[model samples]
Target: MTETELLLSLIDDKLRKCEDGYMLTHTHFLSLGERSSAMAHLKNRYPNHVFWGGYPDAERSVLFLLPEYMEKDDFSLEDEDDPLCLVRVRASSAKLTHRDYLGALLGLGLERSVIGDILVGEHGAEIIVMKSISDYLIANFEKAGSASLKITVDSIKNLEPPKIKTEFIRESVASLRLDNMLSAVFGVSRSDAVEAISRGMVFLNDTEATKPDARIAEGDKLVLRGRGKAYFREQSGTTRKGRLSVLFEKYI
Candidate 1:
């Protein structure tokens, strides 16, 4: 079966389990594209479902299928009933990158689906993971790349993601077209921006956007696959050249 078909089948199974068993059921961590597809497939058919990671604004999340008796509000990362855990990894005298931590985890024979977001900090990293594997990781995980790691398991409620850093950009765009704004904020050629959109590499507010000329409003979030994410904070005013003066916050 195709990958998407497999994912849908798994989702269907979870839904059935929730309905038949009258309990909570969840899928593994899903990427942004997979989550979009899953939501489209579910639509409004299921009202008690929610997509969540350990924290807010998480890029990867799990889709939970709730039974009729359960309210969506009943579930929270802070609750001990959740299926997620926080794995804290502290390095000894060495800073570790996201890739280094991921490589080390995968080297331990764990599937990537079981892992959620990896928040790399100055001296260590905090990883969201399935509770089932938390004990195993704490027992087995030791080093990331060349740095020795001290691993500990904690409640998801204790997960403290690194503070986001952003680079403020104030530029004037000839138009509010996505391509024009992408070029201005990301510092790419107009042609490159258009190409990225056409190639399905650009997402507007977490959904894939293909139209280069699509209107981009203030407060829209733009994510370029290879590049970082940016937010259109606001349109200050028109520049002396009649272009739109826009402010953007690019995550650094």
Candidate 2:
């Protein structure tokens, strides 16, 4: 079965248990894409039940699917030392990048969803992982991109998010279609942008975006696979040529 199907079954079972006055949990962590799907599924199927989802310190989170009587604060995901663990990795030469650390982690046969946000900073990074494989990763995840680094198993209590790099961008597009937006902001050809989107190399707000002609609005986050992540800031005034004048931010 697909991952979404599995989550649907899990949610169905959990919803029944929640109605029976039991607060059940998922046995897996969720990636950004999976989290988006799961939330949409819950909003459609179990709209009334209360659900809380968050990673200990990372940006991407899990779903709690709480019952009506349970408050979000009453749940102590961290105080109970939740199923998440933080792995602090620092290379001495400062040559490590976000992909390097992630590549190393994945090389150890870890699924992407079991891992949360990977905060990359200068000289090092902190990886939020499911506790089930924390030891396996710490012992085996010792090198990244040809450099050996130190890995520490840590709690999620004191993780500071990485300082993301952003650049303001202004461009004019013929339309609000995703390909046009991507081409305008990144200076790619419209055909190339369409090809990228068709190849499943694009994500709109963390979910896989397959429609190249989908409209891109202000506040939308566009992630170009292997390229970069961009956020639509606003629609500025139109240009004299009748093109749409748009402003956005690209995370570098």
Candidate 3:
């Protein structure tokens, strides 16, 4: 089955268990595709049920499948129970890159899903990991590359998200096709944009995109897997050359 189909089937099964007043959770952290697919399934199959998500102030989140009767108000969720943990990884007197942090974790046989966000800083980095694996990591994760590192358990509530650098971009495109907008925004040829989309290098709102001809609109977010992020704000007036002038925020 397709990934989306599999997620929909899983949600249906969970909703069945929810009818028995049991709250069910899937261990796998949902990616954008799975989350969106599951949510869409829930909306259609169980409209009044609760579909709550939490990563405790994290950029990405995991879902909690709840029934119609299981709603809440103002309760603070501790990161300790967030199914996640923070690892303060430090290399003495050395500033580690994002790669170094991820490399260390994966090298220790951790799956990508077990590792959440990796926030790099000046002296070290903080990474969010599955709580089930946190204790093991704290006890064993020692080095990143050839650098001797220290790993300590912390809480996600104490994490500070790194500020993303962004720049304003104003360009004119002949059309609102995704390829056209992406080409203008990233300074690539239209053919290059098409190629990128075909090769699964672009994402529309965090889901992998393959439609080069999809129409783009203002307020949409675009991400080139390894390139950067761009937010389409709105269109200004038409340019003297008869092209539509667009405004965007390009995150570096």
lDDT of each: 0.88, 0.75, 0.72
Candidate 1 structure lDDT: 0.88
Model 1 ranges off by over 4 Å:
77-80
Candidate order by decreasing lDDT: 1, 2, 3
* Candidate 3, 45-111: lDDT as tens digits: 6654432233332434555665554553433455544666678877774667878888878889887
TM-score, ranked from best to worst: 1, 3, 2
- Leading candidate by lDDT: 1
**What is the alpha-carbon lDDT of model 3 when measured against the actual structure?**
0.72
Lowest lDDT 10-residue stretch of candidate 1: 73-82
For model 2, the superposed segments whose C-alpha errors exceed 4 Å read 11-21, 47-60, 71-76
| Per-prediction TM-score to the true structure, in the order listed | 0.90, 0.79, 0.82
The residue-level lDDT of candidate 2 at 217 comes to: 81
Pairs clashing within candidate 1: none
lDDT of 1 at 133: 97
